[model samples]
Target: MSPTNNKKAMCRYAGAQNQNVQRTALPEIIDRIVNSLDDPECFAHIGEEPIHFSTSVREMIEKFRNILFPGYFSDAKIDSVNVSYHMGQEITRLYDILSRQIIHVLRHDCLRYDRECSECERRGNEAAFCVIEQIPVLRQKLAADVRAAYDGDPAAKSHDEIIFSYPGLYAITVHRIANILHQRSIPKLPRIMSELAHSLTGIDIHPGATIGERFVIDHGTGIVIGETSVIGDNVRIYQNVTIGALSLPKDAGEKLRWAKRHPTIEDDVIIYSGATVLGGDTVIGARSVVGGNVWLTRSIPADTKIFMEEPRLIIKNQPKETDSEGN
Candidate 1:
């Protein structure tokens, strides 16, 4: 090799060596940080068996999505000729991935909480099968959701557009799947699924929320549907809406575990943007319309339209620009 090339390679090797030395110099700090993880409250599980991997969970979700909507999210050609074969293959793959993840979650909980052995492997397989069996019903519900979005939004060009690009639909899709697991009382996994959707769509929907069919969320960013929220069929809500619980004390988590803390929107209701409806006793009755920026805490009767009084505006034009005195 040429002398110049050899010298440049030597310099690169020296720089890498120097970086390694600098990284190793932090041994004391690294030891302190590792020791700090001994705190029981810390989220780290040092020396314990590894928990369910988020990447694996995400892959399972994607496979499930492909199963739910064939040919939409996948690269493979799905038609009448090979659709059944494709579906069967994808379902079997999803079942494998999902069962493994379920085992990890159940085992982690069993060990972490000092709980009795629940035969995590068997239960995981059963849960995976259960979720798989309900895909047909889930597909029906998703079809209704897609139709609702297309029917409700004027800008929606087609059902295909809504399914492919709408964040609201994506959030709802994840929520529906997560809700099934939540109903089965599968711990950790459901919340993880919901949070994955939340992270992607900027929509926070708790898996515990009971949302009915034909439900629509338009421009769903900044929307929070809390645990125990009961949303009825054909309900539509817009962006920045919060169907949440009233404020509670520090021990609310324990105190309100099974409590119906969030508001209920009856069937055929429409809640517009920036509305906040809070409290367990608060129910927006059937066919009601809640206007934007309305902070509601109490129950309202059916067919009620709640809107804020129009604010008076004071418009003053800026002083006309003055030309130079000579002009």
Candidate 2:
């Protein structure tokens, strides 16, 4: 073939390749992807619909914390002089926000549709009013948490340090708030609050777990307290401790379903790091000390120290078999 004919064929081939490349270019693909953004609601709405409601609830938490701790949290300037005024303002604002968010969360998550009668809205409004009334109780619980942190951690300089610096205190604070909400039967808000704390502090405490006053958790990473797990007053636990379940429930078909399975920790019990107490039937008696890395399933008596000792091994030498009358 002639060089001119070959060159012409090559040019045609290059032009065809260029057209094909343009057909599937990055910009065109990006335009197709960008088309989904045209609907604002499609881009805006994701996850559960109550997320915005949850955000409002969290804002109330922030305001409550600001009011309770004053100088430790919130951007507002709080000193001895303006503390009362600032607290009052924050509390009032928090009450309003809490009423709205709590009602929304309760309607979306808790209130059984079957139980709703003609006076359902009135009952809900009354419940919301009761929740607002309970804010002082929540504040008292938070104060107790701060006191617990201060008493428990030697490294904590003051109550302010516990409020500002300790993640455990933060987690406990959230847990206390969630616990109150859970007790009020406010549904998904408590779990959401607990999960929010878990995400931030690495402490997964179920809101349904009944924890008494002065409960202290130190260096509280990877700590999990299961639902129905009752923690007594002045109970102290370290990092990497799990109070979980031993056995789950089985269905009629004998299929195991994840159910309430964690243990109950009695008062004055100190669980060291890496200790796991499993099963609802298992109980750690009062004033007992559970050592680090110990796995406990059974109930311990009061004032007992639970620990594991290293097992001793004895090596035995077996006698050699004699071949046909000691060869």
How many clashing residue pairs appear in each of the predictions shown?
Answer: 0, 3
- State each model's C-alpha RMSD to the native: 3.3, 10.2
Q: Against the true structure, whose TM-score is highest?
A: 1
> What global local distance difference test value does model 1 have?
0.92
For candidate 2, lDDT tens digit of each residue in 1-327? 799999999999999999989877978789877887677677533333344445665676687677656677777777889888987787778766766665665554433343443343454566556765776787787788778778777788888777787888888878877777777777577898888889889999999898988888899999999888999998999999999876543652244233446788999999999999998789899999999999998999999998878569899999989899796
Candidate 2 error regions (>4 Å): 1-54, 79-84, 109-125, 249-260, 310-327
Off by over 4 Å in 1: 1-21, 325-327
The CA lDDT at 281 in model 1 is: 93
TM-scores for every predicted model: 0.92, 0.73
Which candidate has the top score in lDDT? 1
- Ten-residue region with minimum lDDT total, candidate 1: 45-54
Clash-forming residue pairs, model 1: none
Model 1 agreement with the true structure over 206-279: per-residue lDDT tens digits = 99999999999998999999999999999999999999989999988888889999999999999999999999
